[model samples]
Target chain A: MTADFDAIVVGSGMSGGWAAKELAERGLKTLVIERGRHIEHGTDYTDFKAPWELPNLDAVPEREQVHYGGRVIAASTAHFRIKEDDHPYSVAEGKPFRWFRGYHLGGRSLMWARQSYRMSEMDFEANKKDGHGNDWPIRYADLAPWYDHVERFAGISGQAEGLPQLPDGQFQPPMELNCVEEIFRDRLHETFPTRRLTIGRCAHLTAPTAEQQALGRGPCQSRSLCSRGCSYGAYFSSLSATLPAARKTGNLTIVTDEIGHSVVYDVATGKASGVRVVDAITREHRVYTGRIIFLCASAIGSAHIMLNSRSERFPTGIANSSDMLGRNLMDHVSGLGAGGYMPGYTDQYYKGRRPNGFYIPRFRNVTEDADFVRGYGFQGGASRGDWRRGGGQAGIGAALKQDLRKPGGWSVWLAGFGEMLPNPDNRVTLHPTKVDKWGIPLLHIDCAYGKNDLKMARQANRDAVEMLQAAGFQGVNERKAEPDEPGRAIHEMGTVGMGRDPGTSVLNGFNQAHDVPNLFVTDGACMASTACQNPSLTYMAISARAAHYAAEFLKEGKI
Target chain B: MSISRYSGFSRRQLLSGGARIAGGIAVGGGLAACADSAGQEASDGLAARLDTLTTRDALRRPGHFFSIAQFRLLERISDLIMPETDTPGALAAGVPQLIDRMMVTWALPETRSDWLAGLAAIDARARREHGVAFARLEPDTQFDVLSRHDGEALSASDRAYRQMKSTIVEAYYCSEPGATEELRYDPVPGPYRGCVPFDEIGRTWAT
Candidate 1:
């Protein structure tokens, strides 16, 4: 059967945006489906609003506050996040999993922290050496060019630290570390020669290039209001960068508020023929056919769609010949760190509200052996305390006001992101009876951190306190406990991972489905292992690389 | 540092009104519709009808969850916590209104009850000490009652007092006068300077 479009990308987020742009620019009639409402670029953003201007002073409404205890929904970007009750997902008994999601046109790209870091050769080879998860078919060298390509377009601001485990990427001028941070960095490095702390590699244009400027994007003003959506297009987001490029190609069509239900497979062709979508507002079911399909609808979303896609040949699900489709779920073990005061930096203060922070690249298990197999990295910053500190103090009235007018003592804290080993037991499946408001079967996520993850977290916390104490910091405090639940990091990956063997993986080296050609899953779902660094940058590179390959294959009539 | 980026209420314009004490809607440009008819009883009738009783309602009304007497006490206590010095303080910044709105819209019902109970406890102390309500008591007496309550709250780890105080402090600082005049506010702070002398920028940043 002739498809309605040349290609269909079921998402418009971090990876979907790249796929749409690459496919559309290559002259394919691409249709992008978003489960959330459409948002115009500059017009939709409320980034210019001050604290007083925001509703309830940017607090969540009381009725909805219970659902937003995670601090994901602020009044500024409440529209971007999903209500927990409205979109329900169950977890396995005795296992707690938090599925933090933003399901709008740009998905999480609009509300992401924008921390961009490249996974190194060690990350790709980790699974092969350790036997924790399936071996990655591709290496850092394969995706390095794509990382360079995406970094150039995304305008990643980063300092080039010559670290092997954490590879340096093509970057704009890096945002500078503050006075206390600089001191901490020097002292820490001097004490421990193996460890390095550099400025965070973030997707904010410190200096916009001519191409970025032509796209109506400007340099970051350092407003530190990025989660509210940057009207200046200073930070990388689907609405800011990729979607505009895709629109410019004149081969893109967007259908928002359409939840992807399942992939329709043709028995004769043995390929996915179309996708069934349920209208989010009207509850109407519709099918949109395409020659090729890209499932960049997040890690779990894509897995759910694939798992629900039942067929006569593949009775379990479409392209699930190996039964490894919803297996090997992983998210970075996070929320373990230390904080302390840097006493001497009282005289020094910073100017702008720099969005990016200092990054302590993974040191453990890279140079020296750890109690755990994998390592963790720290993302942290140093800043002088503000007026809020006065709340704890015993003063009030004129004297209190005078004291608060002067900035309080300098404090520093580091948040660790540790790698989680991929276990098939930590899986996502369709709930038998329970369904969401849209009638889609609720996904039952059953994921928990293993012993290695806990050990790594503990070590990371201990190391953070040790580093702070070594740097002459006072009153060092460490969170000895690990994250109570999985998915708190929001870096979920490895459900439909890319690997060498079709029997054990869903996607191949190029992010093409092993069982079904002309089908790609190039988001976090394609990751074989959850690297200690942020995964969005890696997802961007993989999506771009896959789209390029898919386009070439289409031109050559390979499918 | 560019304060002009935050458009709506300027420090001078707010000060000129001399503590009219309108809620959240009085500050930003977007809420001009509500701010225009803020003081008029006739306009307030329409505003009241439109009020959804959400967290945002506190922006439009003097109180949401609190009764008239409770709200008056809240305003007085907030002012005492942060009195107007050279700059605008809690009362001028509409901290009580923020609390009233937050209690209804932001707080859980249990949290709201706890806050009310805490307020009643302070009033009880005032009545025992000076034979009047906390708001009607003399300034020094009110301060003494609050000081004792504050000490008890700190020692006992009272969640209600902490919540009320934090809300008041946050609301005060985020207000125009408190942000721009008392502390330094830079809406667009381009090119961060890592190390600047304390004398270069005297006040703390209002972010």
Candidate 2:
């Protein structure tokens, strides 16, 4: 059958945006499908709105906030997030998961904390060495150039730290560490020779180049209101970067509010012919045929779509010949750290609201073998208390006013992101009877942290406390690690993971489904293992690499 | 200015202009530009002025959740926690109005009930000590009653008092005049000066 477009990229977010950009720039007519409302870049951003200008001082309505776990929702970017009631996913019995989702033109890219870091060679070899998950088909050497490609285009602001666990990337000048952070870094390095603390590598343009300036991006103004969306295009997001680049190619056609239902398979060709989509608002069904398809619809979202794509040739699911399609779900085991005050730096201060913090790269399994195989890294900042501290402090009237006018004592905190071993038991499946408002089957996520993850979390907490104490911090408060529920870190991965063998994984080296040559899943769903570093950057790099491969294969008529 | 009607053109222009000035400083002198950038001065002044104006306008809205008498009491309580000194206090910054609006729109029913109960407890204390409603009491008497409750609230798990006090503090600090003038509000500080003399910038950052 004749295809509607050359390529169809589902979910216009971090990965999908890159896929669309690469394909469209390669002169392929690309159709980008987003299952949410359209949101324009600069015009839609509310980052400039001050607290005084916000409705109810930037608090979400009670009923709405409660539905999303009663957490503090900043008023500036509340519009970007989805209310829990609107899109419901079930949790398996006794398993609690917090699925933070942002469904809009840019998906979670609009709301993602723009921490960008590359996974090291150690990460690629971890699963194989540890014998936990399937070994990745590709290695760091294969992805190095691709990481450089994405990093240069994205304008990552970070220092070139020579660390094997967390590789240095092509970066703009890194943001400066605050006084307390500098002190902690120096002292910690002296105290623990193995651990290294550097300023976090983030996707903010410290000094934008002419190319970035031409794209209407400017240097970050240090407002630290990035989640509200940067009007200056200082940070990397689909809206600020890839989608616009794709649009400029004139080969990109975006259809918002079009939910991808399933991938249509051709029995004769044994390739995915196209995708079936349901109108999010109109409930109308439409099938758009494409020569190639890329499922970048997030980890769980893509898994759900693939699991529901039952076919005559592959009755279980398309590209699920191994039955490993919706298994081995993983998120970074988090919520363990420590915080305390630093004294005697009252004379030193800092200017500018730094959007990024310091990153302590994983030292657990690097130099010395711990009880656990994998490791964790710490991400935190040091800052002085403002007037909000007055709430708990004892004072009122003139005295209280006088005290608050001056900055309070400086404090440092560290939160760990630990690697979770991929277990097939931690899986996602479609609910048999239940369906969403769009009539798509509901996703039932059943994932939990394993013994290794819990042990790592405990060590991370202890290390955090010890590090702070060793750095001459006082009144250290050790935060106990919480019971690991999946999806808290929002770095969910490993479903439909790429592996060397087709039997153990759904995708191969280039994020291509082993069963369907024309099909690609380049989002977090293609991760073979959950590396401690932020996964979005890896997702972008993989997506860009996969798109290039897919485009070349199309030219060679390989599929 | 009404947020819905705010064009945000002037602010954006001002910020971009400031950014250019900062950029010029960076080009003129590499690391030394951090010490003296006129761009920082321009942006800081503009942000402060805008914050003051916005906060002044926001404070004028009528209470939505609390009754007229209850709102009056809340205004007094808020002022006592953050009274006017060199800068605008909680009441002047429209913190009471923010709290009232939050109650109607954002606060849970239990939170709202706690606020009402806290107000009543204050009134009861005022009547017991000086035989008058909390709002009707003398300024010193009001302070004394609040001070006693503050101690009790800290020691005991006084949910009502804790809720009311925390809300007042949050609303005040988050307000424009309170955040900008009372503390240090730098909407755009350009490149972060990691370690600087505290004398250079005295107050804590109001992000």
Candidate 3:
């Protein structure tokens, strides 16, 4: 029987968009399903609004904020943020997971921090070397070309530093480091030769290519109001970049407001022949069939769907012969760093809000071995505090206004993003009883930081403080306050990880399920190890590479 | 005076011009004109862009939450706190009016009550200090009384006082005149000029 589409992608988000774009471009008729409301590219964005233009001082009302679990939602980007009341998921009693999600067409890509970095050879071999988690089926050599491919399409701006731990990528001209940042970089390098600071390698177009320009994307305007979705398409987002590219192929079909409930496993075929979806609004159920299925939903999201996909043949879930489908969840150990006031640079200031910051690559275990096996990197910037400083401080007259006029002293802060060792205990499972508005099972996220993760946090904080202090930064304070729980970094991954052995992991080297050849997971769910760098760029590369392999496999009639 | 709303710069201009428009603003220093152009656009236009969002009509209407007597005290206190310098002051920027409207629309009932109690305490203090209400006191006397109250409240870390003062400052600075005339207001800064001399870009960025 002929399927409805050649390939069915279960999401329209970060990796799903890439999957759809690559699959469609390679002459595959693809279906992209989104659970959120439809959002037009440029029209829906609020980037043009000034502070004065926004209502209620650009703050969500306390009454409405409570609906969002008391999370402060900026009025400008509030549309992108999901209301907790509408999309409720259960968290384990003691394990508080701040599952910050944006359930829109573009998903978190619209609000992503855009700091793009490639996972080096060290990151891939980390799991095997440490034996914390399952060894990755593929390594840096396998993904380097794909990273270059995606970086060319999605413009990454950065100054290439020849570091083994954090590999550089195909980059446009890097955003300049400010005077204070330059001083900090120079002093810190002089003090500690191993630790090097370079401008953040972000997926923002500093120089728009003919390909990007042809897609109506332009160069970065450095507005720094990117959380409110860029109308300029200066930043790489699914809505701005991939979805449009997929649409241009004319082989892609998108169905919004159709939430993926589960993958329908055909007992006879031993493959995921179709996806079962529940209508977000109508509460109606439907199934869309395809030759192959790509679960590009978020890590937890895809795992939730797979775990809910119970069948008689595979009682646990589809493609769960290994029973490793919903295990080994991970997120970056974050909220550790330091900040200090820079004494000089009173005569100098920076113009325009640079959306990017400088990155200090992982020095621990590479340049200097720490107590922990894995490592972390620092993402920070230097800037003078704006007039908002007057809100908390003393004085309220002309003197206060005058003091606030020229901006305050330049202060530098470094926030650490460390690799979280994947533990089977840190897993996502469906609640036995609870269900969401669409009658889909609620995701029970039971995740917490391990001993090594906490140790890394403390070490990261100490390293940050020492780096700042050694650079002659006055009033340097260690940022010891860790995140209340995991997922604060919003870098949740590794629910259905790739491994060399099928018994240990779900996906194989090509991100295809070992149990079900036609089923692929190229999102964060397929990540074997939680790399120190941001994972979106890796996800993009993986999705593109997986789609290429899947296409080749289809042509060979391997399935 | 009503807090003027800016518009007119289409999403098309923002998207199509991209870095070029931002580059022009960085080099030319015509951000004030760009910010003012937003105010020049029809206020109704904003309503069409965003769903269920209307610009705060603080100065366009009478006091929403505050009583007339209490409003007079707020107006006096806010002006004293952020008096007219080269830039517009709190009163001119409609800060008191904005606070009053926020009290009714934005603030929770507890917040409204706290602000009311804080306003009453200020009046009571004025009456105790000088045999008159705060609004009735002489300009210099009112300044002295408010200054003392400001110092005590700030040092004590009084939540209501801090919130009120912050609102006043925020409302004034976010105003078109305050943002454009008082501080630099760049809507679109093209390429980031990371290090520029303080004299080159004199005023602080009105973000």
Best-matching candidate per DockQ? 1
TM-score of each: 0.92, 0.91, 0.92
Task: Give the Å error, residue B23, model 3.
Answer: 28
Off by over 4 Å in 3: B1-63
Cα lDDT, model 3, residue B126: 76
Error of 3 at A480 (Å): 2.8
What is the docking quality class of candidate 3? Answer: acceptable
Q: What TM-scores does chain A show, candidate by candidate in order?
A: 0.98, 0.99, 0.99
Q: Of the pair 2 and 3, which is ahead by lDDT?
A: 2
Clashing pairs in 2: none
Encode model 3's per-residue lDDT on A1-559: one tens digit a residue: 7899999998888899999999999999999999988888889989888776666778887567887888768888888988888888888888888888878898888989999999999899988987889999988999999999999998999999999988888999999999999999999889998889999999899999999999999989989989988989999999889999999999999999899999988888777889999998898999999998999889989998899999887788778888787888899999889999988778899888999999999999999989987999999999998888777777767877788788888999999999999999888888899988788888888888898999999999999999999988889987766744788899999989999998888999999999889999999999888888999999999999999999999989997
Model 2 Cα lDDT, one tens digit per residue, A1-559: 6899999999999999999999999999999999999998988999887776677657776656766677778767777878778799999888887788778999998888899999999999998897999998999999999999999999999998789888999999999998889889999989998899999999999889887888899999988888899998999999889998998999999999999999999888889999999999899999999999999999998998999899887777789999998899999998889999998878888888889999999999897569988999999999887777777777788898788777889998899999999999898998989999999999999988888989888889999999999999999987775635778889999888899999889999999999999999999999999889999999999999999999999999998
The 10-residue segment of model 1 chain B with minimum total lDDT is: B51-60
Name the runs in model 2 displaced over 4 angstroms: B1-63
Which one wins by DockQ: 1 or 3? 1
